[model samples]
Target chain A: EDKVVQSPLSLVVHEGDTVTLNCSYEVTNFRSLLWYKQEKKAPTFLFMLTSSGIEKKSGRLSSILDKKELFSILNITATQTGDSAVYLCAVEGTIGNQFYFGTGTSLTVIP
Target chain B: EAGVAQSPRYKIIEKRQSVAFWCNPISGHATLYWYQQILGQGPKLLIQFQNNGVVDDSQLPKDRFSAERLKGVDSTLKIQPAKLEDSAVYLCASSLVGEGITFGQGTRLTVV
Candidate 1:
């Protein structure tokens, strides 16, 4: 079985629409869930979710983690063309700093 | 602070040739990482270094691949007799205290 799974391998939306990306994981010694946005080259860190329930937000992007189900949700409101990129979900283990990453969701926001 | 730096932004070499990628992590960062990402795939960790010592290199193909972090500042990943399967983007990332990671632009390798 895979350690991390991301739904909707690709997505398309209007500039003003809202989009949600999902990630689920099953790893031993789960520690934290992280989200990153990749455009042309390297993936840049977006949010880090260590605790559940509380949402982490930056601009139009927000993410929340659910330890019970071992899942995470990334929500983008009022999306723009600049927001078009691949969103990656990563799960870090507690015992070791090993991180398992999802395949990523390709998001395209049309202007 | 300057972000992680990688050399030879892109390389296209024939199979069986040797190629090397270099990385310079952010200053004061204690941990460094090397990752391989095939086309349309997520980055996969190949090695990890803590300061001047190696923390993990289980995913590295020791038979044909080698890496070294000299002075705990700069790192070099070399592949000898590279195979077609070795074509991928090699990324170097660094972190302090594991809060988050800063990644390099990556060195894209194309084994023709």
Candidate 2:
């Protein structure tokens, strides 16, 4: 079964702190890894990583994938309360547009 | 540049009751997806449609769950005799070829 596992299921940190979330996957015919931030209802797109070593960044958020190791990491620098949300990791497979998603990491940035 | 649209932001029904949800994908988007998101969990793909054809519905519980995308623009998902365990957020999303998906505010379902 294709599976995506995310570590640190939940985290709490003070404002201005930095945090890192982890995601590991096991699947056949891996295509790409994606990150999303879900606040209340919908999950907004974050980053999509297809190549190893090349990191994708946006403002204070960044992510990287390691295909060989079958893992990925998302980093948030200078986190604020607004950054508190569930971070999800998903992997798209080569088999007919299928995607496996991890349970997600719930982040709470306390002010 | 409107995003994916979904209706019935919230629904409450007794177990064994039936309910339906609607979704309107972004204009020209070829792929539409319906996902179920339980509390504290990431979204799970329930079905996928390519244009007006069913591309994937392997995970969908066809016994009581059915969905259709007519005219390749809008879609609807129906759940018959909903169970308490079925309570969750149903998310609708759409994506163009080789593009990231755009999600709509999900419909929160509560089966009492």
Candidate 3:
């Protein structure tokens, strides 16, 4: 079974603070790693990391994958109350179309 | 152009009752996925389809749950004799093979 583990299951930060979320996975066949931000309903796509070392960024959120280490990190800077949500990391297995997700890290940004 | 769509934003049922949810993937998306997400947790894949063919469904509870994507577009998930443990948000997503999947708003089911 493919397992995805995330550190700091929950976090709280004041506005303008920066936080990093970690995700490590052990899968038989690895293909892609994805990050999502979920509020109340559906999760919104944030980034998809396919290569190692190269960081992908959008506004204040950025992420990087280390394939050799079998891990990834999502960084958020200048966090706002709107940034308070569950950050999820998922990895697609090498053989099937299935993707296994981590339990997620709940982030709370205080004003 | 449009995102994946799911129906009955919320549902409330009693134990042992049966319920069903629907999904419509984005146009031209050849791959579709169904996921179950409990509160405070990430989505878990229930099934996947590619062009009307089953790609994966190892996590689905076959005895009480069944799903289908007909004509490679719209899909439905049905649950019989619901249990409290089955209460969760059912999410529908679609992708284009190499691309990442796009999710629907999801249907939250509450079992009493």
Q: Provide DockQ values for all models, in the order shown.
A: 0.65, 0.72, 0.76
> Backbone clashes in each candidate structure, one number apiece?
0, 0, 1
Model 2 misplaced regions, further than 4 Å: none
Model 3: per-residue Cα lDDT over A5-87, one tens digit each: 99889998999999999999998778899999999989899999999999999999999999999999999988999999999
lDDT of 1 at B5: 97
> After TM-score superposition, what is the CA distance of residue A32 in candidate 2 from its true location, in Å?
1.6
Identify the candidate with maximal DockQ. Answer: 3
* lDDT against the true structure, each candidate: 0.90, 0.93, 0.91
In candidate 3, which residue pairs get closer than 3 Å at backbone N, Cα or C atoms, i.e. clash? A29-A94
Worst window of 10 by summed lDDT in candidate 1 chain B: B93-102
Model 1: lDDT of residue B25: 95
Tens digits of per-residue lDDT, candidate 2, B1-112, equal 8888999999999999999999999999888999999998889899999899998898899998999998999999999989999999999998764466789999999999
Quote each prediction's TM-score. 0.93, 0.95, 0.95
Comparing 2 with 3 on DockQ, the higher-scoring candidate is 3
Interface Cα root-mean-square deviation for all models: 1.5, 1.4, 1.2
Model 1: per-residue lDDT, tens digit, A2-66? 38899889999999999999999998887788899999879999999989899999999999999
Sliding window of 10 residues with minimal summed lDDT for model 1 chain A = A92-101
| Model 1: fraction of the reference interface contacts it also forms | 0.56
**Candidate 2: Cα lDDT at A66:** 95
The sequence of per-residue lDDT tens digits that candidate 3 reaches over residues B19-90 is 999999999998889999999787888999987999888889999999988778899999998999999999
Q: How close to the true structure is residue A61 of candidate 1, measured as C-alpha lDDT?
A: 90
